[model samples]
Target: MSSPHIIVVPLPIAGHVNPLVQFSAKLVKNGMRVSFIVADYYYNRVMSAIAAEIQGEEDCHVGLQSQVKLHSIPDGLGPEDDKNDMPKLFLSTSASWPAMLEKIIQEINGSDREGKVTAMIADLHMGWALEVADKMGIKGSIFWPSSAAFLAVEFSIPNLIDQKVIDNDGVPIGRQTFQLSPSMIRMDTEHLPWNLNNDLVTRKKVFDFFFNIGRALKLTNWWLCNTSSELEPAALTLLPNLVPIGPLMTPYKKASRQHLSEEGLSCLNWLDQQPARSVIYVAFGSLTFVEYKQFQELALGLELTRKPYLWVVPSSVITSTKFSNIYPDGFNNSLRKIVGWAPQQMVLSHPTIACFVTHCGWNSIVEGLCNGVPLLCWPFVAEQFYAKTYVSDVWKIGLAFESCENGIVSGGEIKNKLEQLVSNEDMRERCSKLGEMTMKSIQGDGQSSNNISKFIQWLKE
Candidate 1:
């Protein structure tokens, strides 16, 4: 008779946490109880966002009094840590997660609450959650905060390795292009997601760990993807237990359309004046750092495109010590007309925005797809390369830049890709259809909504 209680643990990144929060809100609306577990460093930001949303509701007094509990766990990394040191942070977090989670479980068990934690949902990248849930004897699910297409590509690494298509260094050894079945995604050696140039020991360990984790995915009770099945039928066939429930941006939908600041608001007004589907919106996700030269090239490329554009080049991206000398002459003036720190969802959803030049981070990919905007993939590192492949090759909605001997792409290449994506009507139509299907999947009678319902029902049972 009690409401089902679930504990959700998301990766520390904003992309991961945003969807988990949205999903938790939905569960709460559906007569279940939810507990959000976040890392200490991110607790303030997450809690602040939630508070702001609650206060913005029409019945402000009642909404502000509503309680959604947040639990914090130490990330094992310090508060001021640089994100670029992710490998070190990953190891620390992995080693610490089990203990942190166990302690939280013990406290929950002792609290004598009416509805106890019946299930656990963790970010897929947070693999250590499996051990914690197993030890606690709780039902466990993994939330893949990306498209099922991306997941399919990640899952196929072992097969690529077995076929000798991907070498031990995680690079494709042959000059020929490789196409993945099901999605029919094409990939070349230059675009491989894995690092081919790292020392053999480091490269081997990274690949082995990822491969083992992919195999371990089979042990989960359910898989939740931040995409709709209609958008990626091929991925659903490959992952039977997978569920798509997303766009996962309820708060954004509920918020006022007006920008929170003068600068961002001005940008939106400017965007409104552009022709429908004619502008380019460029951003690397929150954590990407680009050398000054790369940033300059991108700026120059955008200038050459001569299209109205909005770009977010974070101060961190340009100020790194190693990349300090890489800035282009008169860089600030070149991008003076564009917006900075643009509200991503608002920008993406605008009808005037035609294309995205992106780093292909998972959340950004989902946002772009939800808006039906095509991409010009320029992935930097980690999972981005896989995402790029899905956008350009798997979906037929975007294009990839040619990489050079230094593995860097130039402004000329960026300009060419932008022109191609913006001018191609077929690509635009496909992307639009994909967007409609994606929206449908997250709503009534859609596969994603049904999957969430089923997941909750199973928890109660």
Candidate 2:
């Protein structure tokens, strides 16, 4: 008669943690006790968010009281550590978290009721936790935050090396375009995630990261993708035991209509004033850096289109090493509104959003797809390029911009693509249909809902 207790490990990154937090909420709703494992520096922020959610929930019996808790683990970061330095932070966590996690498991085992820990769900970014759970003799599974294709690629790193497509370090060697499946679009090897980085050390680190994931994967049995079943059939089919239980966001019916911030409110007001499906929503995921030159080109393109746009360009870009004094003159005079952080799901759900101009991060792609907006993809780094290949080529729901000779997207290319996208009725119709299908798959008795339910049942068992 004891409650089921699940330990959930989340990576410090926003994209990784947010979906897992949402997944945790869903698990709590299904009557499991949950503990969110977070990095020490992020402890206060995570606890605050959880407290807000708890305080906001209705005062019903056994209402999330003692059912959720935050467990902090040291990431080996100092007060002066630059948290934004991803590679540094990751290396720090890689050295410290495993032993920290093992100790946490022992403590919970000695203190918790009936089952010390019934199961542990780890984000794919922290795949090493799966082996830790195995060492602790508990059930474990990975909640993949990226596309199934991305995971499949990681899983096949060995095969790729054997075939001479990539080396021992995972750098593509003498690479050309290749296909993983007949239905999969041929991918340009140069655009592969690892190759994009010019820094040899950084590229090697990233390359090694995937192989580390492959090693951890051998200890885990289940992978839950953040994709709808209909979206990437080939990719899901690429690996056995990969289940589609996704578009893992807040439920549409219960989502807030309120704006996230004053800036968000202003953006919402602007969106409200536009005609339905008339404004473009542009954003690159938080981690990707956009150089000033590229940013200027993007502004020019958006201005040339003469269409209303909501652009979420982080202020970090303005302060980055790539930044220059050369600003695109007079972007404010055009039909555009730029802000820092955006309430993306709410924005995509807005009636005025026509299409998304994006870097094609998995979370953004799913959010856009769920809202039925097609895409204009300009991938920057990491799994985003794979996302671009699938969305633009396999799914036929978006367009990908090719970088010009200057390694910047020309204003002309951006303008022409935006014009072509908006005017193409067939593409629009397809987007609308795909969105409808996505909506269907995540509802009652739908494929995604069923998959998630099955996974929950497995965890409970």
Candidate 3:
């Protein structure tokens, strides 16, 4: 008998691809074969992310890559195309991928290679893949790679519309605070994941995309989420098919830690010299563009912290039209080190790291909590505001930065938040306790582990 085979598709973003690939590695370790697909343009990135994810999985690292086949389909974008135009990328993939995926499915089933494909799993953003799988007679599941609460809010879109929170165009009725569920956080209409963009045209495009996802939700029965019931009991309660199977990370093993880039190693070495729990680690994920004014404020803010810090400001920031210069003038200082990127998981797990100053991307949120590092939330857009709510309100493990006039989180505000975050012993204790629970959920017979076993059992059957 051949090992059960599955096709895994993720949206072509680092946050989406990273967790899904890490989950694919989990499937590989459990005696299954996986066909991991990415856009042709992002193939190298997917591979790099996979290499980083498995770096700590020493016991399974060698054979793991072999079990998971990497497949790339054309994204219909050119070498010089601006991939940062998200609406364009989303539409391009929708236009080009379905047929390509169908072809790939046929080719895999026809081969003697990994046996007939048994199931398909895709990122929630790539919901249309489930339809392609259904046409080919395979079971399909949608994977929500972020917070379960986030998905719950998305799932409530129809309700929001019915309640006149928003109309058919996804334009909110007015400026009002609303909660998807009584147990969930109250959010401003302006902060609705699809409504945050100031440009009406782009906002509508994004809202339409998510509106279509609501339609796509009906096409599948299984929804795998990268979270645990213990961590989000109220949120998971609202999602019947959304199984909790995460906090999926490269399990930490001190001797097996490997840095994927030289920058990562250098950053870790800098952390090594800092006093334990005395350094602030700041990183906004791949796509966050800081405005020139905001960038200067952030740079100066970090300087004001008067403590050792590691800030991962991608070098590309210097090239953005938003900036004439990426750093504040006369900003040369030994208290900080700036890098293009850092091996995030490794950095979070480092002893000298005191707090995470983040943009509240869900991946960053989970990683920070998993390492027991409290966060200074600096949300920029979309579901991030809600994520901030979870960290600072529901979880009580972090604090959100307050912005003054003109929406600038001033240097003093940043410094103040860091000071508050570091000094709150109760918050630190809560974060540490949450981290232990998060780690446990993926090990032994914890809820997440059991959920994974159940899903695999069903797949094999």
Alpha-carbon local distance difference test for all models: 0.72, 0.77, 0.83
Writing each residue's lDDT as its tens digit, candidate 3 over 193-266 gives: 77645788877887788878965678777788998876788788777778889889886545343535677678
Ranked by TM-score, top first:
3, 2, 1
Candidates ranked by lDDT, best first?
Answer: 3, 2, 1
State every prediction's TM-score relative to the real structure. 0.83, 0.89, 0.95
Clashing pairs in 2: none
Between candidates 1 and 3, name the one with more favorable TM-score.
3
| Strongest candidate by TM-score | 3
Model 1 gets an lDDT of 0.72
Q: Candidate 1, clashing residue pairs?
A: 293-326
User: In order, what is each prediction's RMSD in angstroms?
Assistant: 3.9, 3.2, 1.9
Q: Can you give the lDDT of residue 2 in candidate 3?
A: 86
- Per-residue error for 160 in candidate 3, Å, reads 1.0
Scanning candidate 2 in windows of ten residues, the lowest lDDT window is 52-61
